[model samples]
Target: MNSKKLLLYSSVFAIQGLSNAVIPILPELAGEGSTSPAVSSLLYSGYFIGALLTLLPFGILADRIGNLKVVSLGITLTLISGIFISISDNLWVLGISRFVEGLGCGAFFPAAYSMIADWKDSHQSLGEFNFLLNAGLAAGVFFSGMLAELEIKTAINIFTLLAFLSFIFLLRETRGQTPDNSGRKKDEYGTSKRVKPPGEPHENRTGFKPGMYLEKTRETFFENGFWKLWGISVVLYGATGVLNSNYADYSAGFLTKPELGFAISASYLAAMLSSLAAGKTKAKNKSIIRAGIVLAAAGILFSLKVPLLAFFLIGAGGGAAVLGLVAAVSRVSSSGIAMGLFNTGIYAGLGLIPVFGSLFIGPLGYESVFLGSGLVLLTTLFVKFE
Candidate 1:
């Protein structure tokens, strides 16, 4: 990846880091924001739900116009939403602001992933993307925990400031151009090579028409193997959601918020290293994904026995499965819809699993939830990609 690609991926780092920055504070968000902890979690629910609802729509938009415009919009909304969240005393207003912030991030994701898919060694590039994302997530948890010790609002300031900075460069990068495809070169065998041309839109001679876009999107997402990949995505990512949504509450018995933040940071660091390691392997994507599932299951089961090292196993699996999923899904869908649907799989699991699983948490225990999620994931080990 070049400097431009690195910068582009940073936008996601900022968006995700900012969004997740609040997780460390979830246990106490109600007191700080003058609401209940359950309601405080609504802020997270709203964000992922917002991301879920818009994945297809914004994806369509990215496929039509381009990713840069969508990223610009996402960052801009994040900046504006931060302001509202900063001043608001009401939980309802805070939730609303978070929802809008989710919309902004939802906008950035598909376009951003789609952009990565267009880059050189896209598989490795996606790993690099995941690496950067984990780094950002780790930073967010650490800083947010630290900042919350002073004031809850201070934590929000960090990502918001980062968003404002990202938007500035995004505007500068996308100002007169879209992500450029004109600079690509062909090898001796006639394979096209990824090259930097800054950010400029790929020229679409077909031109976007309402009916045409609808037709293309339908054709792109509904083809054979699409739903299968989606199913796998939901299961894998939902497992992740189970881990994250319940993290703070689960850790409360064993660790402080800042200590938990350090643990979470360690988890992401594990994920970063996992992705980097996986990116170097020559194994089939299928094997990689299965290995990820096995690792995730082991990690979850281990957390039942030992919580301290659970982060490493689960985090490593998290990165591997996603890279495998992206590579796998792209094979099934030849058009622009692949990355968007992949993201939908992610946020859907993030949202849906926890919502349903929360019911079980109160009745059974965190162990049961982790056990159930892991067992469900292990069932997919036999699944084969076409």
Candidate 2:
């Protein structure tokens, strides 16, 4: 990987870390603002919405143009969102800004994934890309946790600055790599017609357009052997979100300190360290993904009572499972569009699980969150390797 790619990946990791660190602290923010839990969740929820809206379009734009340009725009927007959130006094302001930030974040992963895929055409190189991207994500999570321990305002300020600086570092390196505007012939798909770019001088230019859009949605639910993986992803994410949302409260109320940012941060650290081992097993795609789900479920179950080591297991399990799944999916898909579908599947889990988890919280309390996640993982046993 070149320095530019490295920096770009690093900026993404840091941004993800900074933004994600906000999850565990939502409750705290809620109390500070005297808002309800549901309302506070909106802050987190808004981010996902931003992701949902921006992810698809940004990805298509990246494919149409250049990934580096998309990334540059994303980083700038992210910095602005962070700063806006840092200075805002009202929850709505913060929420909207976070949503905007989420949009930026939405662009980050897809563009980054596309770049990595385009850059490295080999499996080994793909593993390296996953490792580096995950490393940046881990580092960001750790720093976010550490920073959140400070005054929320102060932490936001510093994080915003760090995000800006990181973007600058990345922007300098990712110079060329933009989309080709010149007229070029379309590439070969597995089927009859070649996939053409829009506005090309051709017959229909409408090959598999409907099918292309529906690929992820259809496969995720209706396709054979997809339910298991999809179910696991959905459940795992919901469980993670629920637990993450409430962890600070659990720690402040029952465990060692009022601040569990470090605990949360530890999960990212564990993930970072675990990737060192997980990356080695990328060649064994299916096995690694299943192992990740199992580990994550087990970790969540264990952490229900054991506060001291909760994050360690959580980090190890979640990090390994997600990275494994990503590696597996990247290999399965030959084109960038398929990669977007993979991301959408994972983010769907990230997006939907918390909403479901929220419904169970009233009487169920925090432990149920883990149970829900575990149940979700049980489906992983059925996921097909293809």
Candidate 3:
């Protein structure tokens, strides 16, 4: 693990940890006698909203300015927003801060993926990255629960400190350095490697034009079966999102906070393990995706009765599905724009789907949402993907 890689991975861990740290304490944040479920759900979704807005633009900027540069900016924003969330009690302030924090994540992921995709063993590298990503989510969930009794903000403060440190380290590491592909070297076979030149359009061309970014983004969407992967991402992540956004409140009826946290953490832990495993598997991406859909659908359908088991299945399946999807997209176009759009599908599912599901909780109850999500996942199995 070189310092650069370590910094990148640790930063990801910190950001993800920060993102989920608030989950266990949502009730506390909502204030006593606040009856609206929408507040809690909106606060939860705010981060994703911010990420959704920024993912694509930041990705394009990463290609032009450099991935590390974008990552550094992300960390800074994360640190700042984490601090704001820790001190504020106003719902609007917290909501805005959460959005800003999500923007930080939106900046980090596409840039990070672009950098990782350029590595010699991109599949394995992406697997490791996803592993750490879930580990961070798990740790955040667990620790937030553990700390909630002591102080609702403790976990946030701790993770914010991590973001601060990561930002400082990144600044020092990148001081006086400019990001480019100029340092790329030939492989062991002595053949000159082909590295995507910095600032190049998604078409892999040398020169850029005024409207090339939009043109290439449109082309990338229609090329190499990318839309299929994007569709899969939305459905797969949407199922998990429904669970993630509602499960904490739903389980409050039966489980203690710590137990609830553990259950949620279990899902992330499963995902972490599955992602690591998926990286090493030789299975085709399509096959892996299909299998993941099955597992995830089962998880969602049975979530209310077997909360822990269901969550575990969801995490495991989601990890594998994401690994396959990301790997597939990377194969088609490793450009920042392509990675950005791919992640947009992810945030769309995570942020928007849950809010949509919440609308039906009054009339249909949580079970209907879960069942509908499951059915939706199953339906995707029949969709043709080239």
Candidate 4:
């Protein structure tokens, strides 16, 4: 691969996996701050909230100003905020810093995904991206586990250093590189060779209108199969959130700091393999998606009896489902906008499910939260996407 793609992959691999690292170290963070695990989880929510707010806006910015700029800006933000995270003294500060990290991620992914769509077959390319994503998570988990053996602060500091290094590479790539405002590569003669993105008027190609973005998003919202597919995306990510936010607590006796980390990392490793396989499969999107939901539901249901097996089953199936959703969305709208909206659904589910599931923790017990996720995934069986 070229240097540009390499740098982008490195940045995404680190940024996406950063959350998994944090999950395993929650106890250390809580103890250091003298707070509860419940409070520490709000930090994840803070990141989700920032991602939820900025994805579409950043997508618009990428479409108008060029993806290279947006990604470079994102890398800068993540690098700076990640350093601040190492020094955060309280939940409030940590939340804010995580929020900034989320903003950077929100900006990076759609633009990066859009770029990948142009460089190669998006389906296969997306598979490679997922591999890096999960591989990075596994690496982060191992690193965090090691740091937990010493100090959580060291892990945070190392994480910041990695982000800084990624930023340097990304910055180098962006220099003297300029794509068109519409995010298309120029033809040899210096004119756009690709069609304009969704919702802009042909008469006035002058600049971005803030309102045009909203209109395109609204149009996609009402598209025939969009909401159905969007619902699946929501349920998928919600189930993931259910595990990430609750599994550490639930696995108290079954696993400890790095052990839970390793288990979750194994889950993502299975997902990475599954994603690569799915990309090569000719199966229909609905077929794979339904299979995935069913597989994950069964895993969650049997989790308490066999946690490791359950985690693997859930990750493997969920990987297929996630790729199916992204491929589905890409076909229906402007690539960047579609990806941005899709990400919004993902983080929305991530942010919302745990809040509602937390209620079940008091009455039905903590496992009930995962039970709710299983139920949510089960509901998709009766429905079809597109």
Q: What is the TM-score of each candidate against the true structure?
A: 0.82, 0.78, 0.87, 0.87
Lowest-lDDT window of 10 residues in candidate 2? 184-193
Best by lDDT: 3
Candidate 4 per-residue lDDT over residues 1-386, each given as its tens digit: 66666777888777866755677766555554323445555665667878888888887777666666678877887887777778776767777888888898888887777666655355666657767877877777767766677877666677677788898887666553545565553322112225644323222456667687688788887686788788887887787777777676677677767777667777787788788788789998778888888877877877777777887888888887887777777677655566677888889888776655655665677676777788888998888666
The residue-level lDDT of candidate 4 at 152 comes to 72
For lDDT, candidate 3 versus 4, the one ahead is 3
Model 3 lDDT-worst window of ten:
184-193
Candidate 3 yields a Cα-based lDDT of 0.80
Backbone clashes in candidate 2 total 2
Mark the regions of model 3 whose C-alpha exceeds 4 Å error after superposition: 32-35, 117-127, 176-210
Error of 4 at 274 (Å): 1.1
Error of 3 at 234 (Å): 1.1
Model 1 vs truth, CA RMSD: 5.1
For residues 239-275, what per-residue lDDT tens digits would candidate 2 score against the true structure?
6665665566545566432235556666767777777
- In candidate 3, the residue pairs with backbone N, CA or C atoms under 3 Å apart (3 or more residues apart, or in different chains) clash, namely none
**Every candidate's lDDT:** 0.72, 0.63, 0.80, 0.72
